[model samples]
Target: MSVMRVAGLSGLILSRALAMTVDFTQTESIKKGAGEAAWNMVRYYTGNNTGDTPGNLPDPYYWWEAGAMFGALIDYWVFTGDDSYNTITFQAMQHQVGDNDDYMPQNQTRSLGNDDQGFWLMAAMTAAENNFTNPASNQAQWLALAQAGFNEYVSRWDDADDTCGGGLRWQIYTFNNGYNYKNSIANGCFFNIAARLARYTGNTTYSDWAEKIFSWERGVNFINTDWQVLDGAGNAGTENCTQINGALFTYNAGIFLYGAAHMYNLTSSDTWKQRVTGLATSITTTFFKDGIMWEPPCEATACDTDQQAFKGHLARWMALTAKLADFTYDEFMPLLKSSGVAAAEQCSGSPTSDWKGHSGTACGFSWLKNSTWDGNYGVGEQMNAMSVIMTQLLSEAAAPYTSTTGGSSVGNANAGSNTNSDNLDPAPITTGDRIGAGILTTTIIASLLASVVLMIKE
Candidate 1:
């Protein structure tokens, strides 16, 4: 009996020791840990597996999450220089761009919220920004695909009809729940995507839309006096989107921070720079406890799968923000580095027979306990854990490319303009379009090269 008791204690000790296995400073360690975490996260994706469809996740996992997954996978590839998952990521992304080249794939329409579509759109945007391999020259180019989706959202901006003045409603379809709520997240994503598009395209229209969205959010008090972003206001005609939900979410904070950072980068405006600083300060104060990020509303209470994955988005945007607005790199890194290392420690989930016989390093959810796995595992948990760890690899990464930079994705400024009642994409990208894009790229490169040559001659 004593020996059995001793064995049980030893097992518990081993389970608790699962964390602290990852060293954030070492490139190889971070890559190995990120690879393992990514593998575990992808296991939840049966949608594109042997028995499943090409770009979807099976049961209980929503379509929006698949986009989020691809976004993280893109980051994973960029961080570690790994191409193992690129094929699957590419396949899944293309399969979901819908007929209009927007992310409104037919399969997800019934339950698709604006935020859902936005997640997929942002993934395409990420692909364009990072210059992730473009699809077949015959298929949609990344930037054009993103522009197509951005155009669709611009059309959907609810200023004229909605009671919230200018905010996006939570659900796109009226039949869906929360259709009346002009959620902060919906607008936050729209703003986030717009800012990125603005920076990538050098188009003032995108930046102007981003400003309009930011102004609307502030006007409605969704961004309160403290710059702490609140959840959506319930908008049932008379309710007027005024009765605020008064809840905070980490993803919202991250969304706002990243977008503001882009605005700062684009215009070098003090106003945007200040907003970025405020948002980062609020993010750290509200979400971080002892240097690790956490969800205040749902972490202590139970979080649904959707809530579980929120931190990954926060970490993702924060990393991107740090890169885009180099000024905030110092302010953002301390916590990012701490949370990342803490998260890495929890990657050693080797569950024994006493632990339900799980055999891999399944990532845990909570990073509060020192070197202790929280004993929970899922796609959300895995992604959240890996995201923070992968962020540590940022030190080794180059800033993302813009159209004027080395970015190779071809774009259409007007991809998503809906001329038909069916909302079809304006037209398929033609050979002429590709040639025009090539000429544009060549011109930009030539101009840059000429400037360099002139400088050398001088």
Candidate 2:
């Protein structure tokens, strides 16, 4: 079936949950499976898997990868409040920083790349600020590392253009071509990380950088008329429509929207607020259909090389749109829950198969034929999906606008209660705290097992 059909089927399957609890347990098992799949991919990177796996490499000390997983772990901790998640995530951040005074060299830092590192830095800063008082020294260290990384990134990439215009290039080539392309994704990261740092540090410089970059992006690259992102220079006038390579990148738009919203929170800038509203409207009206956003129209889709890659992008975009639109859990939850249910129903019994590059067991389900990149799912996609879902839940529970009003007296009383509850110190996770974690753990394991069995049967 087409992803659209699958998405439609999902709505039917999950209609009942629209008015019910938005707790993790109430979500579909497949959605949870997808979340576990993301975490498992990180587990592989962290050398936390069971077995003395022969191919296992030492956990990455690189900043970008570490930062991505750190962000994912923070999302996990926030959603499940599992202390182990916090502990493991903390260790991973420290690992990236290395031993005292033997810190990883600047040359090795990945923030210079202008992609994953910026996003990861934002995530790390968020975690550090949240947990600042609990583990003062560790929090300080993470924050310091992130700040240093940001400073280095700015020095290397910030050009002479306005803050928005002169952000980092998509990738830094050591080769002498100086062919750095200004990309939407990288600039989006700059906006997000800089704004986040500003909030945490009360530094106007970071906020200044964020505001400039965001304005530049909207005014320059983003096609306000159609909401399409333009490829730079040579590809000028052309909308980016390729996956991973900046055409219709959902994550790029997602990060930009999120950053714009957060910046509005920091400065209450009408311009930033309008940017968020405009982008959100553009995304909803342009990309979404039958509650699923189609993946970018890539050469792969045209060549029929692999449809799964497209599917991956579609899922990511839907998750992102749901969050940025600030769709109440009631309105947005069905998109994922339904998709999982449809997958489960369609592949009830089939031969279990594996996609070539994707880790973990695969199911025999095939949504698109003649797709070359079919079996090669990665940790990145899963992590993106998990983060989207968790963020959506948190966004809903917190009622994002509550903060905007400067007080709890607003339209959402439940959210006000939640805001108060969140302000209370999170109790240390112990035997008593295990109940919630146990539920999440059980749900994840059970979902994975079910998916494997379903794939095998199919």
Candidate 3:
């Protein structure tokens, strides 16, 4: 309806005619709505073709958030069949796979945590599972990149040495502040990737790792019997991870749930299915209110840049879980449907729009407020909205590919640094990190020898 046609229309008729933001019943509507929301999200991205960075956003956004953004973009291409953002997504993933082939990029060394690196692992895994075009044969293959990150994480697994039985530390670098904590998102990411890799490669080792993580979380009480996914706990020797943080975040729940769903997919065992049932139910109980998805913990005004992005992850993995576990489709779809419309309704905000009659397209954080347009905007908000809306197309979308089901990305079992041994562990290492102890010892010995020779000459 154009401005001219707006004239003389009855209020009720006009209201009924206009879809709030999207109509899930129509595939075209879902695609159009998701595409518009994604385009608006891209407007915030400055790393596409300019001199900034191929996959990075501007200052306010962090590197890992960029990983999450590209992950969403991968899903966008999958759901809507749009290739517009593929180049940048590919460039970003490739550029950030630091020298060791793990996602521990040098530029983000100080800030890179296991969780931060895990987000990018998800993007690569998403590409492989969805069959997003593989990179040039010379570049890191998607499956291998995911495997590399997984390998590095496995190397860093806090086994006999660290706290809370076994889990990835929140931060990889010992100098970082959170090194003393073991968080669910970091370990959950490892578990999620492990499950998917197991399915994608027919590798039983990854499945074993996945099962171990699930057991550790439950055994350590990071995941309670009710399946409530808490945030983190203190490091091993210090707190023994005896005190769980108990804070709830959608991403944490989604991450664990996603991995569990894949576990059920891979093993048709009753044990995995029961675990999936518990986690999926927990997703709805903890994150959703009567079928509408919202971040109960942070959405009520305290969502930092990172927290604002959590709901989108929940929405995305929920749809994915539904696809992988057919039994979950019925329970998950209602949440997806309700949240998609709610999210889309808040997307009707832009600077140019007049409050009176015009509306523009920029997503907001408060989807529960719906149509009221929460007046907040950023990459997180946009990704959240887009993730919810695009997934509404799952009814028409194909199921994700498994190893025997058309997956084409090559794999390298030893992709990341396998350096962490009996007493050595490293990650998000600085640019100069070569072969660790050998290079450092060699340099030290050479200096000592040169000093002795100089003293003899003197």
Once superposed on the true structure, which residue ranges of model 3 sit more than 4 Å away at CA? 1-20, 236-238, 352-359, 418-458
Candidate 2 C-alpha lDDT tens digits along 350-419? 1122212222222112322211113222344335344434443443222222222322111111111223
Question: Over the stretch 1-458, how does candidate 3's per-residue lDDT look in tens digits?
Answer: 12211231223222323333677888998898888777767777777655776767776678889999999999888888889989878888898888777787778877788888999999999999989888888888899989888877787886654466578878776556566667889999899999999888888888988999989888888888778887776654446777566677889889988888888888899999998999888778778776678776656645667777888988999898898898999999888898888888776654332122223565667777867665566678878888999888886667778879998888888777554222334334333432242233344333323322110001
After superposition, candidate 2 runs with Cα above 4 Å error: 1-35, 46-66, 98-112, 132-140, 157-165, 176-179, 231-246, 299-376, 388-392, 395-458
Candidate 1 lDDT score at position 124: 90
lDDT of 1 by residue, 1-458 (tens): 22322333344456654443676667898888888788878877766656678778765678888899998899888888988889899999998888878788787888888889888888898899899988888788888877886777766666633366666767665556555567778898899889998998898878988998998998888887778888766654455766666667788778888889889988999899888888887887888998888887767755666777899889978887888888777877888889888787765566433222234465667777646665566678778887888888887777778889899899888787745212432223244633443443344333323322110001
TM-score of candidate 3 on Cα atoms, chains taken together: 0.85
Candidate of highest lDDT: 3
Q: Lowest lDDT 10-mer window, candidate 3? A: 449-458
lDDT of 2: 0.43
In angstroms, give how far residue 126 of model 3 lies from its true place. Answer: 0.8
Ranked candidates (TM-score, high to low):
1, 3, 2
**Which pairs of residues collide in model 3?**
163-236
Off by over 4 Å in 1: 1-14, 17-20, 351-360, 419-458
